[model samples]
Target chain A: MNLVDKQLVKNKMGMRLIRNKLIKQLFLMATLFAIIILGTLLYRIFTQGIGYLDWEFFLSFASRFPEEAGIKAAIIGSLWLMAITAPISLILGVGTAIFLEEYASKNKWTRFIQMNISNLAGVPSIVFGLLGLTVFVRLLEMGRSIIAGGLTMSLLILPIIVVASQEAIRSVPNDQYEASFAMGATKWQTIRRVVLPAAIPGILTGGILALSRAIGETAPLLMIGALTFIAYLPENIWSGFTVMPIQIFNWTSRPQEEFHYVAAAGIIVLLVMLLIMNSIAVFIRNKFSKRY
Target chain B: MLTVERNRPMASSISPIKDNSIYTVRNFNLWYGADHALNDICMDIPTNKVTAIIGPSGCGKSTYIKALNRMVELVPSVKMTGSIDYNGQNIFNPKFKVEELRTSVGMVFQKPNPFPKSIYENVVYGPKIHGIKKKQILDEVVEKSLKGAALWDEVKDRLHENAFGLSGGQQQRLCIARCLAIEPDVILMDEPTSALDPISTLKVEELVQSLKKEYSIVIVTHNMQQAARISDNTAFFLNGEVIEYNKTDQIFSNPTDKRTEDYITGRFG
Candidate 1:
């Protein structure tokens, strides 16, 4: 080959290498940027909140005095809300997914319902809170109880669970169904024995994600008139409740300097709860997820 | 000395087949929306015999076998106008319970489709659904079924392990054992060995041969030699029609039709 041709080839190779390196560096820079922001937030939260994160902070009730404030009521309320939301949403979501995926014939009406559900997932959380206020709180006369709040949160996250569950159910191979049916298994039997077991990991992963979102949600609960300063744990589903986010919101909004530290501590508690739940999700997914 | 029937109505052969037949398909025509998938199919599948249906791809061989178990109904747009008599009952009749019909007619697929569960669970799945709740009975059924499929020795120790952990051949055998556990009178295999290695294919063929003594076996296959090796009766399907159906020896040795001869000789599909 001529020197000019060789030089051109060399230039092209050099350009390609440069381009590859540039793209790799760009992606790496983006990742580093995300990590830096996350690290900064975590560092700030820990440094600001570490002092306030102790037994008294967890055990004491919300009080006018910042030092005397605690998240006992908030923690219990969040757990109660979750205890209601998780089962209701999971049952309704998984049932809807099964009905849509297995029983319902593919038609225009089903497609319309599916499309609306996906749309519902993207709707602002505040809108669901308003909906809860109108329907559960007023129309239904649920009166801003834990049940009302839980039901509202369930509605907000139901779409996400349904979508995730549909994906999980849909991912189950048709061969499994066919094999089961060929063995004279009824539709319910096949779903119970084959489809549900195969889809459990995915279903659980979805449920965890939905519940996590529900736990972090403050807007809907606020709109539904949850108290910012509950001193006692709710006795039942019908009793009033206030979750961690609202308590944190209450603390952060106060003018006192100590309340900011308390808010940061509450944030830490919420993050840990989310971490625990997500870890369980990951465990279930890894433990049970199958190739086919 | 071999009687080869060509384009004959199924009713004429019913008298001879009725005594020994497990499935009598008469004028079985199926349509997937506008496309004719199985056209005027008529065949007598005998009891305790391996009947292999051989055809080119998309020639309705698989469709026909699936029809035997009424699995074709799973397709939404599929329509059929025919009578499939299984044990003196018209399966196409709305009055007939499909689940009951399927209980007597089990199926294995082209690929090894174990239920993403342990081998023990896969085997006991059918019996459990059928209300066989006693643990002792299930254990007995699992052992008997696995042994019957000639897979007990290989999988006996690892019965609790996920079935996907097993080799492809073992998975296929597990599927067979699963079918056997249900104690179905007939087993429809839609190219059961097509996805396996040569060794696995041979193992499945041998199992099919042995399985015939207790269960009526209907298989759809692209592999002609597999049919020759295992099936007692063979049917050559072409363009949604059965071109020839006869004893395996006669069909392979002296196929009456020109198309059947061409197909077996690899002249053209």
Candidate 2:
């Protein structure tokens, strides 16, 4: 064949070898970049911090330096915060979602409320902290203890929970709702029986992720005047408390090298907790994704 | 088993009784935004019999059925006039409860949409909503309804299993059982078995035959044979109007209107 014929007969993009080679190189490079980013984060966390994760460190309370610093109070407080935050936010979010999805007629105000909720979820966490300081702690007169912090966290996570709940409620096939409706079921009956049960997996994943966000929250609690030094277990919601993120923040910001080690241990604990939460989120997601 | 085997199906049998008219639709006109979907139609669905409304798709068959239960009122742009009188009371009356009407006039969709729950829960859902909380009562309902749908023997052991885990046929049966549990006055099926296999279709058709003894059934089906097989009274609808409505055997064998005959003969649907 002539040069013109040979050119036309080759692959459309280019020569076969050239196209294949470029694609393979692109794939490898993309993968390599991902691994590098992940590796950097992992290396920085482990090499700098894993050495400080000993039994003595875990048993200690927060101090000026690594020698006396521990995350016991912070750990316990976070657990308390989560215990209060998750269920309350879940109930409120799911309630709002049901109202919007099932009952609310399409109107300008309802749509505006729904749209702004999603927007609120994306708002900076620090803004929520400031707002919480103004609203819950100051205006409502709830002091900046675990309770106040938890209520603030609830608001911070509420938007995301609502949006997540709406998604869960929406994911239920219209057929299931129709089936329940056709079964002489009232609107609430249908929702409680068919829609809620079907959307449970979706709701659970959203709820867990929302709780995870609550666990990672620091900015809101800090601004709400969360105590930086709570050495003892929190007795009530109104008492002074310190969350794990605050402890990590307190340590990481300190100039002393020894304090950094304490921060590392805090980071490790937070990471392990996050890891467990994330795995559960993944398990639920996979389970529902398959069955649903 | 009242066989009117005459060339012309005795129209005398049309309004046989006074108190038996379950849903009396009088001059029903419905509009969807600008389109006049249902045009001044009147229909009487007798109690305790399967009334199949057969027509080409988009001929107001589904719309008219939905209107009877006030479900069509759910759409924002839908404007409906006239009343649906059920058992001497207009269901669309402002004093009547919408939720209660919907509960009484139960519906089954074209697709098999069992709640993604256990077979037991799916059956018990309606009664639970109506406030039947006693375990013994609910258990009896679960068994009776599933048995009513011809599914108890197959699904009794798998009560706790998710309804989605069932085959499509079983899921459809579960939906029917779910409806039956409420013991509604009228049951509306919008092409319930159109999504199933022939065997599944037969099961549903048989279920319909038995259901008519307790509940007035209004069904919309695309299959002419299915209408002929299961329906006692048939209404042939075209262009949102009832072309011919008479006994099922008459509609299939000898329709009074040319449009109904053409539809049954497959010249046009």
Question: Across residues A201-250, which tens digit of lDDT does each residue of candidate 2 receive?
Answer: 78888889889988988888889898888678888777888889988998
In terms of DockQ, the best-performing candidate is: 1
lDDT of 2 by residue, B104-175 (tens): 888887888776668898888888878899999999999999999999999889899988898888888888
Worst 10 residues of 2 chain A by lDDT: A5-14
DockQ value of candidate 1: 0.83
Q: Can you write out model 1's per-residue Cα lDDT over B1-269, one digit (the tens) per residue? A: 13344424332322223447877788889999999998887788898989889988999999898888899999999999988899888998889999998888889999999888889999999999899999999999999999998899998988999888999998999999999998999999999998999999999999998889889999999999999999888898888988888888888998877778889999987
Each candidate's DockQ? 0.83, 0.49
Cα-based lDDT at residue A152, candidate 2: 82
Comparing chain B with the reference, what is the TM-score for each candidate?
Answer: 0.93, 0.92
lDDT of 2 at A141: 89
Compute fnat per model.
Answer: 0.95, 0.63
CAPRI-style quality class for the chain A–B interface of candidate 1:
high
lDDT of 1 by residue, A116-174 (tens): 99999999999999999999999999998999999999999999999999999999999
- Per-residue error at A222 for model 2, in Å? 3.1
